[model samples]
Target: MDERIEISMLLDFYGSMLTDKQRDIMYLYYNEDFSLAEISEHTNTSRQAIFDIVKRCNKILIEYEDKLKLLEKFMKLTKTKELILNKLNEIDSSCDNIKISNSINEIINEINNI
Candidate 1:
């Protein structure tokens, strides 16, 4: 995955573990797409300070992901769900029974909501 996107995913999964300041800085830099200088100005800190906070926060997020693997598990489950949905779709399309196909569609939708 792209580095920014990967960090964003990690942040989504593990950001609550970070301090409020760390999470705010990360959200500004990554999600809001703010530059270091912009973040510095907004936060009333030095640009280098903002950079260091972002860097340290990134490390913390990566460490949490490494230790907990929540993001990894979530990705695997999501991929598996997609595969199962695909297979179910194939079955539904090929089957002659409309009721069974509808049931399969419901199953697929339920899985997707998870």
Candidate 2:
């Protein structure tokens, strides 16, 4: 996975563990695409302080992911769901009965919602 995307995912999974200031800074840097200088200006802090906070928050997020593996499990579950949906689609295409096709379609919708 891309580092930015992985960090974004980590932010989603473990952001609550961070201090409010840390979370807000990460959100601005990663999600809002703020530069360190921009964040420093917005927060009225030194750019070096913003940089240090971002660096520390990144370490914290990575540490949480390393220990918890929520992102890994989430990726596995997503892949499994996609595979199930693909198989269901194949089965649906092969079916001739209208009722069975409708039932399979309903199942596909439910799986998509997952």
Candidate 3:
């Protein structure tokens, strides 16, 4: 998996466990792609403080994921969602061919009903 995606899942899985301040700093740095200096300026903190906070947040998030496997579960869920989306796209593309056949439409309607 991509490192960014892994980190993103880790952040999502473990963010709620962090203090609001930590969460805010992490989101600013990771999710919003803010530089440490930028975050410091925005939050009215020193760069070193932002750096320490982000590092601490990373450690906490990592520990949480390691203990709980929440990130793993989230990653699996993401993969499943992508698979379903791809399958749906394939079905959509095939619909053009299947449109001429009533049976396929019936099957599609049945699947949709389910």
Candidate 4:
């Protein structure tokens, strides 16, 4: 996974835990693609303040992830489903392997329900 994608997913997963000010700053910086100066001007704060707030919010979000692991669990579930589906496709291409492919598909469905 790319770092940008990981960070983006992390922000999405834990965004609700942030204070309003922290959420606003993070949304502006990451989702809105705003510069620090722009965030500071919009929020009427110093650029350094905006930087510090964003850093602190990131630390808090990461700490929550470290302890709770919701994002990690979600990522693992997604990756497992993808791998299973890919294997099923490979087996489907082998005409002699229909039964195995069907079983794999069933297992994939069950994992998705989890």
lDDT comparing candidate 3 with the true structure = 0.77
- Tens digits of lDDT, candidate 4, 1-114: 775566567789898888888898988888888999999999999999999998898788889889989899997888987887777667667746667777867776786687
Give the Cα error of residue 62 in candidate 2, in Å: 0.9
Across 1-114, the per-residue lDDT of candidate 1 in tens digits comes to 899999999999998899999999999999999999999999999999999999999999899989999989999999999899899989998999989988998998899899
The numbered model that scores best in TM-score is 1
lDDT per model, in order?
Answer: 0.93, 0.94, 0.77, 0.83
Each prediction's TM-score versus the true structure: 0.94, 0.93, 0.66, 0.71
Reference-based TM-score, model 3: 0.66
lDDT (C-alpha) at residue 94 in model 1: 98
Better of 1 and 2 by lDDT: 2
Candidate 3 per-residue C-alpha lDDT over 8-110 given as tens digits, one digit per residue, 9 for 90 to 100: 6688877788889888888888888899999999999999999999887777777887899976786576677666656666676676665545554555565
Ranking by TM-score: 1, 2, 4, 3
Instruction: For model 4, give the 10-residue run with minimal summed lDDT.
Output: 1-10
The better candidate by lDDT, 2 or 3, is 2
